[model samples]
Target: MSQELPTRLLLIRHGESEVTVKQIIGGDQSCTGLSVLGRQQAEALGRRWAEGHEPKVDALWSSTLPRAYQTAELLAASLGDLKVQMHPDLVERRPGQADGVSFSEFTDQFEWTGDVHPYVPLAPGGESQSDFFHRTGKALYELVHSNPGTTMMVVCHGGVIDVAMRVLLGLAPAAPFLLWTLNTSITEFLTTDKIGVWRLVRYNDSSHLSGLPTHTDYE
Candidate 1:
């Protein structure tokens, strides 16, 4: 059974976005491009992979967002012959009308009533916590089941990684937890069928980002 074999996942956060630099609340639907620094980060990560840091993977997947897709493209370029499969379901949490809004404006109208209904949208036209969580979780589950005993790389967003952490750790769906996945950082997970559990091997590894000026702010 595919589940019986160990499935390795290289869960990566996409490079920084222009929205982060401009202090906007751009989310999934946002088509914001990557910052110059973000491009460099993506290239650096690709160089790291080219240097034999990564093993041949069964597949490379990325979110449909411009930032994520761009990162995947750059990384794939460095890893000759690799192609990326873009998945819309893997996109970051959609902020809907909040997309492209200034940070101050988003906060001014923000409401936190998720405790009442996790399925309720975070904002007008935005996805609910439950919706985001389930979608990301389901995508990851499918990735694991479909690949089985192979390695896969996924370029996505911080929010998606957050949801993955919660799902794999058996944490409460909407439990509050602080997490920060650096731009182009790698988070590893291993799944085994015997226990049908996912084990986190590592989190937020950005050794490739060494000597690079850090951007402390991003969505």
Candidate 2:
């Protein structure tokens, strides 16, 4: 009998950015990076991950955006040996020219219902909610396939995280996830052929950042 493979995926949200504090859509935004506090948070997370002495990581992936890149860089730096790769597929929604717009402006300009449901298509002319679901979800599937039975860390955004949940868990596309993932927080999962069996052992874990900012800090 063959041993069942256990794949561990550490999904991390990028650190806070100026636009995050400003509450902008920030999708595909050309100009944005982590704030001073955000860098501190990422460093804290890197230290915790290093101290844990987790299994040798097979890969470190990040969204092409600079914020995601910055977070992954800190983590990889801590790992010392492992290398980081940039994947455009991991990028956040392309908010079109409407990027950096306030919530009010976003709602006013786009044909949105303010569904209060994140997975809903609130960003018109931008990638539809479903499109994002498939894009990020496909990237995850690809990563898992390559590393089968290995541990990896992926740095991305909240939207990608939500889409991944829907794809791997058979959840409704528009339903809200129970995750409150913060900058540098870890969400762990193991994926298998059976989507229903993909286990999320941890969700929105900030044990790596216990003394960091509160949830309300960015919200």
Candidate 3:
């Protein structure tokens, strides 16, 4: 009997973005792309890959957001200049009407009560927690099924990664825990022969950033 190979899923959070420095809600409409430090971070990861730090990736995917696309581009430049397949499903949680506003302003305008229902939208027209999870789950399921036994790299937002973790690990939706993934950090997962069997190989691995100046900001 031959053993089945596991499908490798490499999830990477986008580098720092302009919205992080400005402290604003960076929905698709408000995203202005990576900042100076963000470019450096992405480039560093690229260099690491270029130097054969990890196994060769078969495909590259990224969120359509500017920040994510930019990071993907930088990474592609180093990874044999691979093409980045953009997917809207990989974007961060939609902020809706609260899109380019400051956090304080969003609080004042939306009157968030610190806790919101899972089905309630984050903003007037934004996706609720439940909605975001559903979108992420569907996208991940499709990705895993579409490319079995291949190593795929996905550059997306932290929220998307969090939802992926939950879906893959069979955790409760909106579990009482938070995963603060750093910019450009890598999280890996492997799928087994058993249905719904996924193993978390690593999470938040940014070893390529040793001695490099880095900062974490709200997503």
TM-score winner: 3
Off by over 4 Å in 1: 1-5, 109-117, 216-219
Per-residue CA lDDT of candidate 2, range 99-139, in tens?
77886677677756656444555555667666777888889
- TM values, all candidates: 0.89, 0.84, 0.94
- Tens-digit per-residue lDDT, 1-219, candidate 3: 112766889999999999998889999888999998899999999999989969789899999999999999999977788899999999998999999999888888999878879999978999999999999889988998888878899999999999998998999996899889999999999876647588899999999888877765554
**Superior candidate under TM-score, 1 versus 2:** 1
Q: Please give the TM-score that candidate 3 achieves against the real structure.
A: 0.94
Evaluated against the true structure, the overall lDDT of model 3 is 0.90
Candidates arranged by TM-score, highest first: 3, 1, 2
Per-residue lDDT tens digits for candidate 1, residues 1-219, read 265457888988988888888888777655677898999899999999888867666788999999998999998876675789989899988877888788777666765432446777767898988888889999987877777788889999998999889987798987877798899999998877555587899999999999888983554
Which clashing pairs does model 2 show?
A: none
What are the lDDT figures for the candidates, one per model?
Answer: 0.84, 0.75, 0.90
- Residue pairs clashing, model 3: none
Error of 1 at 39 (Å): 0.5
Candidate 3 stretches with Cα past 4 Å from truth are: 1-3, 216-219
Candidate 2 segments whose C-alpha is farther than 4 A from its true place = 1-5, 116-124, 176-178, 191-196, 215-219
